[model samples]
Target: MICFMKNNLIVSIQLPLLILFFCSCSLLNADEGKEFISIFDGKTLKGWRKAPKTSYEPWSVNDGVIRGEGKENRLVYLVYSEDENLKNFELKFRYKMVTKGNTGVEVRTRIDKTGKRPFEGYHADLGHVGIGPGVLGAWDFHFGSGTRKEFPCQRGTRLVIDSEGNGKHSPIKDAINITEIKKRDWNDCCIVAKGNFFQLWINDKLSSEFTDHISEGRLESGFIGLQLHDKGMVVKFKDLFLKKL
Candidate 1:
């Protein structure tokens, strides 16, 4: 009878420890699976470079945030210079647009001195559009020298871009929830690019996606940049992270 009682006590003790061990192992595996690298230190722009004509006063690091304020006559970009080129990767960051203006992130783009726009590449657009703020999450292609300078795909669109820089968009039944995006508040933005596939997520909701089949005009690889569009605008970005697949 004493042995039976002792065995019961041991089993009760071992069961919780075993359960905890398994839970810890599962958590360790999950953390190991996600190999995200921090691109921004949140205190300084150590691995970033601004466009030639851009002023430093408008771009400053304040309280662990990359803050952009004031005005510029033209668009300017703070390009990531630490990495050579990003081809197949997932980039994520938190951004807040305080002013009623435009801001975006450029991917697979390069600096074009002759181009009219600040960055010549693909842009994940954020901010207001038209009379309403419906087009906060969208995608745009800014070709440096093409006849079609800009090609846009709106939120909840599954688009296809051809080699001639022409785009065809189809509505994605129920992908986006616009109400989830907090205007003038900190929002999450994620971009995934793999080969010809590209996707954008805002506030953990799928906003837009596209496939590029443009053999001649498609960009395979280029630098990543943060854009400040229009004058008298303020935008803050933080928690910039990237994972290469």
Candidate 2:
């Protein structure tokens, strides 16, 4: 009886440790072993579609790049329609803006057709404000379902978003050099989303990081999109790629 009790204790202890060991190994492999796949063929928009009630189709493939140009009165998106909803992924692309244009990349966002807005989710903003000209690389949430229209975290901020679509920002350590971004020129953007953790980079520089703990408004999985905010601006995107984690 004594020996059986000792064996049972050892087994119970080993089981939890073994589970932890396997979980750590899986996470390490997921970060290092996964390979990126090109979602855009560089020559077409075959796997993407415009959101519903988009007044006009402003996106097209030209010269090996996906281009959007128009004077839209509201938010417009070219959403990736091929994959199942993405839960955790890393996405990268190159983009260029022309003539005071405003644009962004949307991740883990859903189309809200019932409302006036076309999408409901997060946006990684790209463009110049009064501060300067280049990729601001700010983080924002567009709340289509609630009274909150947008929650914005300025450049160089590490933001925390709560369940009610509100945010608080602080200066980030090892922030990216915003000067390195080339205005009106092609620059690389990378976004990593895993669970409620998120990171954004511009031109290989770390831009922003955030943890979303919104129990009520947290988004686990949704579509990917490129945004054209308004009229009289041209935005071009290319080399769109993703790696599922």
Candidate 3:
């Protein structure tokens, strides 16, 4: 009887330890739903480096948000603090469109020495209508490159959308429509990536889920980037968050 009780006590002690260990791991991986680990310091671009500007201009920040206004040529940017990749992770932030040109988030991309651009692995697209969540016809360069044509990103969708296309979104659906997107107002953006499965959301609305065919090379890890096209419009970003899965 004594041996039985002792064995039970031992199990009780070890079981709690095991439970605690697993709980810690779970808490570590809980992405978007948990408190965000700040990527931007909100004061300065301390850990960020600007990409090469085509016109030798600079991107400025306002009231804790960073922005780029292109009056010259297109400027591409990729910033990183350490040598790490952002593969299969959830990223959430708030962005506002002032004047539309060409803007989208780039992920799993490598920065080029030219500083003028970065190669895209995958992108959560916004910049069109009839896209974002599950509206249908979501596309990307990797998957629907030559196959899915009719649907493409057209200026107006403000909804966050999930898509694949060499990190540039295509065949948009459920994305925040440009009309619904408040001009000069702050809006929310969210993205989730797992293996080839990707999901995007804007302003808390489920945008879309996509499967990629090209596979952005399945980079072990890469820097996150914001892009601006030649048209020259103002795009503001703030409240950047990232979590590892």
Report the lDDT tens digits of candidate 1 across residue range 1-245.
01235578787876775344223212211334556678888778999987746545668898778997757667878888988488877887889988878888889987665667655777888874331323568888787664344556778888997777677878877676767878778887788888898888876567888888877757788989888887888888987877776
Judge candidate 1 at residue 205 and give its lDDT.
68
- For all predictions, the C-alpha RMSD in Å is 10.4, 14.2, 13.1
Q: Report the lDDT tens digits of candidate 3 across residue range 135-200.
A: 221223212223332224323222222345333444444454445554567766666666665665
- Assess every candidate by TM-score: 0.80, 0.79, 0.62
Please state the error at residue 229 of candidate 1 in Å: 0.2
lDDT of each: 0.74, 0.74, 0.54
**Residue 177 C-alpha lDDT in model 2:** 71
Please identify which of the two predictions, 1 or 3, would achieve the higher lDDT against the true structure: 1
Model 2 Cα lDDT, one tens digit per residue, 80-154: 889748879888777887767678888888866558467777778887433342236878777666545355576
> What would you estimate as the lDDT of candidate 2?
0.74
Candidate 2 positional error at 124, Å: 0.8
The best-first sequence of candidates by lDDT reads: 1, 2, 3
When summed lDDT is taken over every stretch of 10 residues in candidate 1, the lowest stretch is 21-30
